[model samples]
Target: MPRLCGRRGNIRRLTRNSQLVQNRWLNRSAEDQLTDNENLRNQIAITRTNESQEQRNERHRVNTLRQRLARQRVTDTL
Candidate 1:
């Protein structure tokens, strides 16, 4: 019983910490967010540039499937 209670308390503490981190990110200025997004896009572009043709094809196929599934889900919910 005591062990279970301790686990619950730890879970609550972790949840609170994650919420605090999310709130901090949301509170950042618009310029800061834009810069972060630009940096991420640049990183992704660099990574894609290094990938071989096979890897690029696989990534494209996976992305296409994901988009198709997402669209199907949206249509189902409508």
Candidate 2:
């Protein structure tokens, strides 16, 4: 009887090689996602740090003023 042992060996080797390639791809994708998450967190922290109470109040005040002016303009147009 002819041995089919070589075919089995080739199949095992191919499976192992495919698994290794898939694992590497997944690891790289996970690493990139982690880096992106860290960057977003850092940006959020910076934005929070930059918005002090005084600046927030000023921004709110400006927005309110603009809204009032817009209403006035619409009334004038009508």
Candidate 3:
């Protein structure tokens, strides 16, 4: 009877420890997922800003080229 009781106690302790480890792992997983989501959001924002800047640069280049062509046409007519 004493040995049987000791075995039961050991099983209970093992079960409790396993539960604690599982809880810790779950909490860490949630935290890591949240961090990953935030980082992805930041990356998307940066990409949008970079795209906006690139579009503006392209527009400026096109306008400059158009102006240069107009000037060349005028010089040719003269």
Best by TM-score: 1
- Model 1 residue 77 CA deviation (Å) reads 3.0
What overall lDDT goes with each candidate model?
Answer: 0.91, 0.85, 0.82
Which number leads on lDDT? 1
TM-score of each: 0.75, 0.39, 0.35
* lDDT tens readout by residue for model 1, 1-78: 556665566755667678899899989999999999999999999999999999999999999999999999999999
Clashing pairs in 3: none
Q: What is the C-alpha local distance difference test score of candidate 3?
A: 0.82
Judged by lDDT against the true structure, how good is candidate 1? 0.91
What would the per-residue lDDT of candidate 3 be over residues 1-78, giving only the tens digit for each residue? 556665566765667678898887677876788998899999988876778777878978999999999999999999
Stretches off by above 4 angstroms in model 1 are 1-14
Residue pairs whose backbone atoms clash in candidate 1: none
Residue 51 alpha-carbon offset, candidate 2, angstroms: 0.7
Q: Write the per-residue lDDT of candidate 2 for residues 1-78, one digit (tens) a residue.
A: 755676574755667678898887677876787998899999988986899999889978999999999999999999
